[model samples]
Target: MIDTRLSDPKLNDEQGRVLALQRYQILDTPREAPFDRIAGLVKAVMQVPIAIISLIDSERQWFKSCIGMGDTTETTREVSFCTHTIQAREPLYIPDARLDPRFATNPLVTGAPFIRSYVGVPLCTPDGYNVGSLCAIDTIPREYTPSQIEVLKSFAALAAEELELRRVAQIDFVTGAATRRGFTVEVDKAIARYGRYARSSALLVLDLDHFKKVNDTWGHAAGDAVLRAVGAKLNALLRATDVLGRLGGEEFGILLAEATLRDASRSAERFRKAIEAIEIENDPPIKVTASFGISAIGPEHATADQWLAEADLALYAAKRGGRNRSCIAPSSAETQLSRPA
Candidate 1:
């Protein structure tokens, strides 16, 4: 049985909170020793049957590390105790769920794992959003002292710091987009999601047309300025779910989550036009244009490199077809689609 009247808990700044969570790029990633060790320590120190490092996403509460919950990695947000945990700054301590109206009919309480005691400390980001929780669960009623709660909060801070370190390393200094390594990691996650859930997505690789000429004529400083401006402009045009990254010099990559080939084509065209419209205030004013290559994630691609190679092929096609255009790689069933910007 479940509580039919239990409403989904949400933060007042939910959109901002989810965006802050996404900035870490941690969801669906493989477990690391730091997080696993923290969960293990919590379980040991708290003397709980289960301890988890959980991240609350839009639709699910995903466990970055789980101990004592057999093979279960996630649960629907509708049924998650962690959902309620993320709504506040302080730890949520339930001494006996069976006595609490909120959990009296909750599935996790009435069913397997038979959770009775719980404590969750919200994992707050640097920007002050509670993105998830570090929780300890027990199958029987138990009491937690203020000292115990403080210990959990200290663990939660370490988890938040771990997330911040990853975020800082992923960002590009000049463009403010993900660096090459970060972007590729995102692509790998997208691919894993596609394989597991059949979620469709597309990748767009953009290269500035005649970018060398900008450096030769204006100097490296001006070239850097152009990259920065272009990054900012493209970022403004993107949805919160889209990932923008600087792949390398004069090149960028975008991961369009849950988008189809047609959706990607339209997006690529828009980016092409946006890049073409960029103007830098140089001695005589400078304008720049970009070429785009798009490839939809599919079964044919086994690795991120293969997916990127396909997009690169389309990019070369765009270059051959004359720059300032968007081109789609030929699928197994169809020929390449190239559109002038």
Candidate 2:
């Protein structure tokens, strides 16, 4: 079970365990090149045999990437050096773990792992939650000068930047939703989690109607205005857990976590009506509206891509059926192809 008793001011359950782990989207992923580079740089800079980008999860510290270590993850947070680093929200420098009062008797130092000198910089979120650490360990006692510690902190910052860049690259710049590529990654993650834990989720595809007409009549500037307006309104209305993105043109998408068809439909309708009510103003008023296709992932599906393709088919059906209405994909519409709405 996940530990609930050790709540500290710097590491609340939501901020530290849930949000921190979720933001990276790195948990359970196969090793990657960028993280490998981070590990390599840490080893070279600190001259340590072990370096890791460890994320402290609910029950374990998972390595997104590691160097000079065969295991991808370690399951002992209660005794982890990273745990102390997170709690301190500072670099935990034990120049000699075997002599340090707090860690002299630590299993990591006294037992099989035999960690000695250790330096860890907390991996902090933008909101100031210190979730984990980027750390290096050696088998011998060592001291880092002030300059060396600062350099280690800089490396930790680089790791943080890698994480933030991953988010920015995946999220839609215009609407803050997942871009097409990002959506694919999301679906893959969702399906993997569902396959493991058996959870339900929903997807919605939206396209603005008569968007070209808005550009033609009011000029492209007005069209841009309408898109931005709609995007802002949606961002304001959706739950923080929900993901939204514009996928180019007047098309957009949403991933509604842990939502049923009824709940998803309610949310999609709210988005629909919100856009319908957006009245653009100049000397003349221009109004905009959108159509949506919504669907839920069901078990026994072949893959996430196939499921998304079905949703896209339903989107085509909604467009064909009517320009400004919402349509839900019937469970029977499981094929790659779509029908007219």
Q: Quantify all predictions' global Cα lDDT against the true fold.
A: 0.89, 0.78
TM-score of 2: 0.84
lDDT of 1 by residue, 1-341 (tens): 34322443335778888888888888887878999999999999999999999999999999999999998989999889999988776688999999999998999999998999999999988777889999999999999999999999999999889989989999998998999999998898889888999998899999999999999998999999999999999899888889999999999999998887889989999888888788899778889999989999888878888899999899999999999998888871152343333
lDDT of 2 by residue, 69-138 (tens): 6774765777878877876656888899888888989877898568889899988777667766899888
Query: Estimated TM-score per prediction?
Result: 0.82, 0.84
Pairs of colliding residues, candidate 1? none
Off by over 4 Å in 2: 1-13, 74-76, 98-107, 332-341
Q: What is the C-alpha RMSD of each candidate to the true structure, in Å?
A: 4.8, 5.1
